[model samples]
Target: MLGRLAVDVAIYRDRVQVTERKSGIFIDQRADHPFSSDTQLVADATRFEHALSHALRQILKTGAYMLYEPRAVVGPTDPALTPPERALVRRVLQDTGFRRIEFEDE
Candidate 1:
C-alpha cells in the first residue's frame, strides 16, 4: 500500500541509512552497503552517504548511526546493556530494513 511505501533511504559508500523522524530526534540506521536503483520505497534520497559513513566509524563506538526507534535523544544507555550487549544495539539498528530488532544472543 502507499502508506507502507512511504519510508526514506540514505545511501552511504559502505552502507545505506534509513530514517524515520519521531518527536525531535532522527531514528537513523545503516544498511552495510550502498543503495542501488533496485532498492524500494525511498524518500529524500540525497548525498548524506559520507555523513553516515563518517559517523559510523569516527564517533563513539556507539553513535547515533544506529537508532531503530527514533525517540527524543534522551539520557544515557539503559543500565542493563553491557559492551557486547551494546554492539547488539548496533546490529539491530542495521537490520531495520527487515523490521528486525533482536540480537542472536537475546
Candidate 2:
C-alpha cells in the first residue's frame, strides 16, 4: 500500500511546531526544558533535531509497511538552524524520497 505523509515543522526561538497531516494534529514542543538556562547553540540545535526526529518516527510507525510519499512544510523566517540540524532534516527527507518542501508564512 502507498500512503501520503506530510509533516509541517516550524522552528521558533523557544519551541518547535509540528503538524501531522493525516491526523491533523498539532504539537508545540519546547526545544529544551523551560527552566534550563543553558545558552549553548549546539545544545539547542541538538534538542531540536532530536525532537523532530522523534516526532517523525512516531508518525512513521503508524504505517510501517506502506510506501510513503513524504512532504515537509517550513517557514522562511523559521528559527536559525545549525548546519548539522539542517543536514539532518534534509537527510531524513531524502531518505524518504520526500517531495519539495512547502514554505509558508508564519
Candidate 3:
C-alpha cells in the first residue's frame, strides 16, 4: 500500500462528517430536516449507527480496495455524551469496521 489513511469524524446531533486526513476527502450529511436529530449523537442507537455507517461507507468507496481500515479520531460531539453514549459510540465505530477509535477528551 502507498500509505495508511486515517480520518477525523465529527458527529453532531444533526449531522456527521468523516474526513480523510491527507486528502481532505470527506462525507458530510445532515439529518432529514433542520429540526431533526437523525444522527441522534448516540441517543437513538439505530439511527445513529446507520447514519455513521453510511458516512464511513462513503469513505471506503473512495479508495475502492487499497485502503486499510481507518483509525477514526472522533471528537467531542455537539450535544455532549454520557457514559452510555460513549459506549454506544464505540459500538458504532466497531460495527462500521474502523480499525481503531480514539475519542477526544471532553
Candidate 4:
C-alpha cells in the first residue's frame, strides 16, 4: 500500500462467526483490556494516504487511550478537520447512515 491507514474502533462478536473488516487496531496490554479500533482515520484506505502523517500523529498521541475511548465525538473544542479530511469524514459518516450534525462555532 502506498499510504498508511488507521482507525479506532470497538470489537463486538456477532451471532454468526464471520470475519469482518476491522476498522481499528488493538493493543493488548492486559487481560482486562479489550481490543480497540483504529479511530484516527475514519476515511477509506485509498484516501487515508492523503492524511497519513496527521493520522499517524493522532495514533501515536492517542494510542494509549484507544481502549478507553473507541469513538470520537468531534466538538467545537476539537481541532477542525482539514478541508479534505472533513470532506472524507462527511462522506464516510453519510455512507454509514450517521446524520451529519453540523454546528456553528459558538
The lDDT of model 2 is 0.58
- Which segments of candidate 4 are over 4 A away from where they belong? 1-73, 77-79, 103-106
Top candidate on TM-score is 3
Instruction: Give the range where candidate 4 is weakest over 10 consecutive residues by summed lDDT.
Output: 11-20
State TM-scores per candidate.
0.23, 0.54, 0.77, 0.28
| Candidate that beats the other on TM-score, 1 or 4, i.e. the better one | 4
lDDT of 3 by residue, 35-56 (tens): 2245445566667777776776
Candidate order (lDDT): 3, 2, 1, 4
Model 1 Cα lDDT, one tens digit per residue, 1-106: 1112112333333343333332122335543343322323221233233334443333223233343442211123223345553453344334323243333234
How high is the CA lDDT of each candidate model?
Answer: 0.33, 0.58, 0.72, 0.32
Q: Please give, for residues 1-106, the per-residue lDDT of candidate 2 as tens digits.
A: 5457777877655465677767776776665443112442234434556666666666666664333556888755334545565565566556545665655642
Model 2 error, position 106 (Å) = 12
Give the deviation of candidate 3 from the true structure as CA RMSD: 3.4
- Between candidates 1 and 2, the TM-score winner: 2
What C-alpha lDDT, on a 0 to 100 scale, does residue 15 get in candidate 1? 48
Model 3 regions more than 4 Å off: 1-3, 32-40, 64-69
Candidate 2 residue spans exceeding 4 A from truth:
33-45, 61-67, 76-99
Error of 1 at 101 (Å): 14
